[model samples]
Target chain A: MTLVDTLQTSFKAVLSYRLRSLLIILAMALGVAAVVMLTALGDGARNYVINQFSSIGTNLLVVLPGRAETSGSFLGAVLGQTPRDLTLKDAQLIGRLPQVRRYAPLNVGEAELSAANRLRAVTVLGSNANLIPIRHMKLAQGSFMAQGAGSNAQIVLGAKIAKEFFPRTQAVGQRIRLGDSRFLVSGVLMSQGETMGFNTDEIVIIPIDYAQTMFNTTSLFRILIEAKSHSEIEPAKQAVLAAMKQSHDGEEDITVITQDAILSTFDRILQALTMAVAGIAAISLIVAGILVMNVMLVAVSQRTAEIGLLKAIGATSADIRRLFFAEAVLLSMAGAILGFLLGQCGSLMLRLAFPQLPAWPPAWATITGIMVALTTGVLASILPASKAAKLDAVNALGKK
Target chain B: MIRLTAITRTFHMGEQAVYALNDINLQIASGEYVSIMGPSGSGKSTLLNILGLLDKPDSGCYELDEKRVTDLSETEQAQIRREKIGFVFQSFHLVPRLTAAENIELPLTLSGIPSEQRQIRVNEALQAFELKQRAQHRPAELSGGQRQRVAIARATIMQPSVILADEPTGNLDHQIGAEVMTLLENLHHRGTTLIVVTHDRELGARAHRQIGMRDGKILTDHTDDAG
Candidate 1:
């Protein structure tokens, strides 16, 4: 028979058993939709992280005290068991490197600040004047601390802290007591939102030396570095590591990581998550295939007399096989297309709910979902179609 | 023309071999109207199946239109069946999902005939069977006589040279059965070979040749030119 004739005959057969065909189609559609929606979520997470990282300055490097080797062991690190701590002298040496454009020595602590008889506990950040350029910070009033003024009792208030502490007066040039130390506010920062899970608008910044004196520690928290250019990142990282080893008595007990490395690691992990979810969703497609096989087998037995009649009317065994195969393919194709449309709608809903996330399904996942559904459907029907073809016409026709 | 010689078909029922057709010999010329009448288990139906190529004999030499067809391949035999033979069944095995017109067009459709030509042949068959008004009705919607007429139209749509009817009126009343028999007879009068297998003696008497079978063997063969 012609291709059109074969499809038409199978279509009629599928239409005849409405409820059976619908159940199978619904199963197939659910499988494909699951793949699409899950993959979209995974990809959106990856995109969200990348966007978060991109907001910070590029060509940046972080220097944390103690080594974290690539062998996956913590070993004298992360728990502060290292023999030497990263000091301000180490930061001074790294900041002087020719490949380094800027550096910020960061020391984080928490303290109570009271002003005009209003007291509140707040996060305190200790960094240098160059921190404004390196961290992409802005000011709404006054100016940042002067360069080379590490010993001055000056502070910059985050936008939210400024609003809360000095609601009726200018924040800059105002005196506030912080952990038994009095300080003059140098500036009120612009209202920048959260970045890398930390809200910059909630912290108060002071010079690194006074912060060390107030918190009573000589060790630095970590150093943020910006290289002179994109190509200078690797050279600057090596220079900083070499200088740290020299200052710490010839011991390389520091971990130096670039921003690109962290971003790529997150990217790899999220992409693998997408694939894993797609694989789990593909199992449903296989189950749907088994359902198709089961229903087709029942149909073959039910239509034995029809098969016999076809044979008696001169249809060859190959013709019988083609008709059944065509039926399976048509059902799967219809289900796949319907599922793709449904998945698109689901993803659109997700995007509307979480406007920040880019929750669109990738092309590869969509194509593979449809192709796998079709392949499984055809494979499942092989046994039933062959059984129908092998029927003995005389016996199938029954006794007269 | 059709011929069969030394044909044997054995059936094994729980290790005991019984002959469904034993050493049968028969011949019928082209355009001949013949009938085989016998009681149940007499193997008359088995003979008709062998002649229609639906069952293979244990041993046989058969020829149709001067070609040896006993050992033809399955595909080749199907082609021969499509081009040279037609079958009308006792229960009127029309596909219930298809309309009457589609049922009659089945043979042509299976033969890869294009839609325009298939439609023409189906329309002609509907007209000839007097089923023009019931063309769009499904088998469940058609009456007994109308269903049988649709089946007969489907059987002859390929314009085969030979027609085989096995108790074609078994499921109908006397009036509908007579009408269906008359339809088959009308095809036979148009120079098409007709073979009917039945247990009704009155129906068997209408054929030009009569063969009575018993216990898988032919008991009597008679030819009457006047009938």
Candidate 2:
């Protein structure tokens, strides 16, 4: 038969059982829609994480005073104990390394900042003047500490810290106590918001010297390093690692982490998680495939007499098989179209619900969804098509 | 013209072999109206099926128009069935989902006839069968006579050389059965071979020649004019 006539005949037969056809299409649509939406969510989350890492200066490096060991039995590194004496002198030595544009020795401690009767627990950060530009901090009022202000007991309060401690009053030029040592508020920092749940504007920044003396410890918690350019970040990291290796006598007591490496590791972890979720979602597609097979089997049984009559009227086995295959393909194509539209709408709704979330559905994902639907439909129709093609005309006719 | 020599057909019910047609020898010329009459299990339908190329004979040399069709492949037989033979079943075998027009156009469509020409043939068949008013109705919605008319229209739409009617009126009333037989005979008069398989003696006797069978063998082959 002509392809048009065959398709017309198949479509008429399918429509004769309208509710059953619709149910099969709906099942397929749900399967495809689930895959699309879940994969889109995974893409969005991965993009959001990458964007978060990029928000911090891409040329920045974080140095932690610890050793990571790789051994034979484990096949991976175990974290060694950190050296408790990472002082400002070490920070200066690292800063003097070639390719190190600037470095900030940071000491982190928890304390209460009190103004009149208002007191709140806040993270206190001790760093040099380089911390302002190196960490991309900005000022809301007054100014950051100068080079010698570390010995003068002056501090810069973050925007939220200042707002909480000195609500109606100007935080700059006021005194705030950090564990019995009162420091002048030299500047109020601009709001840098939060990353991964750590609020940047809720901390107080002081100079490195005074913080070491006040906290009664010489250990530096972290050191922030900025490179001269994007291309120099790796060179700077290697230089700092070499310096630390020399200083620690080849003990590998410090880690130099580049922002790119951190972002890539985060991306890899998120990608694995997304793939795991998508794999689970694929189970529904398998179920849909089975449903297609079952429905096609039922359809073959229901149309047995029609198949017999067609054969008796000179329809080739190939023709009968092609007609049934076309029916499956048409059903799947309809489902795919519906699923694509529904998935797009669902993703859009998610974007609207969570405006801060990023959306990045890759082109291959949509193509995969379409191909998967089509494959499922074709695979599901094979048994039924073969059965229909192989039916005995006399027996099938006698069945009715 | 058609010829059959020593045509033997067997069916296997488990380990036992049941012969449906046994050493059947017959010759029918073009435009001949022949009726196959037999009681149940007497091989009338089997003979008609073999004649129409719908079934294969086990040890036979069957020729149609001087071409041996008994040994042809299944596909070749199907091609011959499509090109030379049309079938009308007792149940009508009309596709219930298709309209009368669509049903009549089915054979032409399968033969790759273009839609425009198929439409013309379908219209002609509908007019010839006096089913034009019911052309759009599905088989389920049509009366038995109307459905049989549609079936006959479909079977003859391609103008095949022979028409095989297997109890064509078995499910119809007497008057409707007569009308259907008249339609088949009229097609026979127009130079097409007509073969009818039936158990009704009155209907069988109406044909130009009747072949009666018993115990898988032909008992009598008589010309109606002689009778």
The candidate that wins on lDDT is 1
Candidate 1, residue A167: CA error in Å? 4.8
Query: By summed lDDT, which 10 consecutive residues of candidate 2 chain B come out lowest?
Result: B73-82
Q: Docking category for candidate 1?
A: medium
Query: What TM-score does each of the candidates earn?
Result: 0.91, 0.90
Local accuracy of candidate 1 as per-residue lDDT tens digits, B116-195: 99999899999999999999999999999999999999999999999999999889999889999999999999999999
The Cα error of candidate 2 at residue A396, in Å, is 1.8
* Deviation in Å, model 1, residue B186 alpha carbon: 1.0
lDDT per residue for candidate 2 within A1-400, as digits (tens), equals 7899788777886787788889888888887787788888898899898887877665889998765556434212253455444667789898898788988989988877776777778888888888888777788998777655546788888888888888888989998887777888899999989976768899998888777777888889889999888899889988888888788776556778899888889999988877776677667777887888899899899888888888777887888898898888888888888887888888888888888776545566777877888898999999899999988877787777
Q: Give the least accurate 10-residue stretch of model 1 chain B, judged by summed lDDT.
A: B75-84
All candidates: CA RMSD in angstroms?
Answer: 3.0, 3.4
Interface RMSD score of each model:
0.7, 1.4
Give candidate 2 misplaced runs (Cα > 4 Å): A70-84, A112-118, A129-154, A165-187, A228-233, A248-251, A359-362
DockQ score of candidate 2? 0.55
For candidate 2 chain A, the 10 contiguous residues with the lowest summed lDDT are: A71-80
Candidate 2 clashing pairs, residues 3+ apart or interchain:
none
